[model samples]
Target: MSLAERPDLMTTDPVTWDGGMGSVGDYIALLKPRVMSLVIFTAFVGMMLAPGSIHPVLAAVALLCIAIGAGASGALNMWYDADIDRVMSRTAKRPIPAGKITPSEALAFGMTLSVGSVVLLGLLVNWFAGAFLAFTIFFYAVVYTMWLKRSTPQNIVIGGAAGAFPPMIGWAAVTGGVSLESFILFLIIFMWTPPHFWALALFKSGDYRAAGIPMLPVVAGEDATRTQILLYSLVLVPIAVSPWFLGFAGVTYGIASAVLGAGFLGLALQVYRLRTGEAARKAAVRLFSYSILYLFLLFALLLGESLVTRMI
Candidate 1:
């Protein structure tokens, strides 16, 4: 892109480059593999917790499909967001924005994977899971990326549902439908997303402003964003511990959830109470960093609980 097209990425006049010499790794980056890790983990937890038996081979197939479908969603998101991504420092080096992959190539790659994953999943596993996976890709690519992202300050708030669906899909893969158990898993992620992302948005308000994406921090101001974060964190604490209370998990999980939920609330409070200077930034960063670990550990406890129960 020329200087006019993307001064954020290009220091000089626009010059055409052949979208870089993409390697296997570059293509993988287009799939947002880092983001997929959480999705894959939560899906596995769902599959493990679900009440049913899937053949080992078929179980692997289900996971592969979930991973591929999630990757396709990421690829499509990158394709659609390339313009804004080029301007955001955090995303400026993504495959599309970095010119390692062309938009058309990304779109084609995403579409092909989307169709293949859904079709194979339906045939190999169950139609319910397959349909859910297809809807996830569509919701992320079209509903969230294309529509909600640029149009609303609550984009992440709603777009988070797309991320929340994977675990439910995994549960469906084994059980052939969703259950209350699967839905609580979904809710944990759903409630967690706003506070998690708003923390990053708090630290990166300039990026959203430059990209013209109306994130809560950009549209609602820092005070409002911080308040929302604390409120969400408060709500998330009880939900995080509910699996244990509801009898799907053990006392070990109850303790873990209680501790992690407390930490999450504490961090949110730090972000809310402390404003201005490096202290505020640090609070946001701490919350963002810990939020990821909090989710992983919460799910890990459930997976461990399930395994121990089966063994005993």
Candidate 2:
């Protein structure tokens, strides 16, 4: 049947299809749990690195709110992006695009969670964090997904600030305000975003082209994209080490940042040098994979050093 005639196929009853229980996994999938994990981790690291201590229960509530906020953003993003997602091969299997969840339902779910998270955080935690959470949702749903993604080649560059807000939110949860230290964490993620995303964009150029999304590789040539990726990586190296120079972090994080920064630059160079074929694809994938590892390791080291200092 044609797509137009398959209304039943397009509409999803998530409740009926999964026999009511819905499995723990499908619900988790709705939250974009993998991304949520990163949100939780980075936010936790930010909290740990910030001055002062929070009660464990308060900490738990703050993290829960952050996770819900992240999920809410993802659901809204999925809801809005579902159209292009249906067309893109990589995103076609997502819950909304696959008809496992309807767009309206996803939108409602996201809105509910968004409001609930902000309210609970404001009441149980602090308004500073709650405000940040609310802004994050607005930024991701309205600013990034709705406006920026379709409008410019610098979409990721600008939209990245939304993702970078998690650490600041977490820091606010602890200190009730933003600081240069928190912004340092934010800066690291911000600087890392373009290279990280462009690496994926390099290989997914076809999917983006088919979806009519003007990613770097689609608007600019692959060669230009590669050069931009290398340049961003070069800029990120020093910024990643800035926390150490500023005394928010120690020599341990500084050394680790320098090493990882060099490794990231090496990968970007590889991506630049590789020929435009399967080899280039492999290099892009490798950079994408390592980029995640690099960010996680950098934050993990920061958390570890903070813990060691606390113990000492």
Candidate 3:
């Protein structure tokens, strides 16, 4: 249904959060700490790959700022989507919907982190990196969570850019600007996102429908989503191996990328061919699970290559 036909689908009634003090754990939940780990790892890889060395303390601070910025975006997303979250079984336990934290409090907390992260990064690292972090938070919180998610089925396709910026941001922290290598890192994540996310969307179509989200599977149906996933996976396989061609990675990374990319493509193909049932869910889940490992192993190979080179 078009939003115009069902305005209530996207609109939420006002919710008031009592200023009741929650535990530290509750506050951490508001930050979506698990999600922060991915940002930290990718950003760390980017920093390690940059051409020059930053002081250890400064590097630590930069990573901290990045984590906090990512957390702030998560908080803002929870705040804005609390209503939809309450209806969806998957997200119903999140801090906001569970009443562990108030939307107003989350807003204040996110804003504080967002500003603090950018300013501290600028003061301690460089203005360019700080600006980049600020933009990343804004793009994720405002652009993706607020604008794109409910508005279009292509939400993950475009919104994935917000998540892709971390490596570039990390590179900027060291080199003071984006380099082609860092962008390749960014592109890998950007392209991997659709296939990764769509796989989940396939299995979680019910949760999305309940929340009125326009996830690819929800909006376009299963077969279309499977085709799109296959198409993205095919394109992504080459991009995953491109770092080796671009000369930033070594034979170890090249070999790993080739193997992992093939696994990724094969899983995506499995998803495309399966019919709806336990078999279909198994394929989609397998693809989704392997996609995470694919990204981590690919980046880890680059990191390992760098370490061995330094020793040599």
Candidate 2 segments exceeding 4 Å error: 1-24
lDDT (Cα, tens digit) per residue for candidate 1, span 114-208: 99999999999999999999999999999999999999999999999999998899899999998899999999999999999999999999999
Count the clashes in each prediction. Answer: 1, 0, 0
TM-score of 2: 0.92
Q: What is candidate 3's CA lDDT for residue 5?
A: 95
The local distance difference test score of each candidate is 0.93, 0.91, 0.92
Clash list (residue pairs), candidate 1: 2-14
**Candidate with the greatest lDDT versus the true structure:** 1
lDDT agreement of model 1 with the native: 0.93
> Considering only N, C-alpha and C atoms within 3 Å, which residue pairs clash in candidate 2?
none
**Tens-digit per-residue lDDT, 231-278, candidate 3:** 999999999999898998887788889998999989999999996799
| Candidate 3 wrong stretches, greater than 4 Å | 1-17
User: All predictions: root-mean-square deviation over Cα?
Assistant: 6.2, 5.3, 7.1
lDDT of 3 at 66: 96
**Distance (Å) between predicted and true CA of 32, model 3?**
1.1
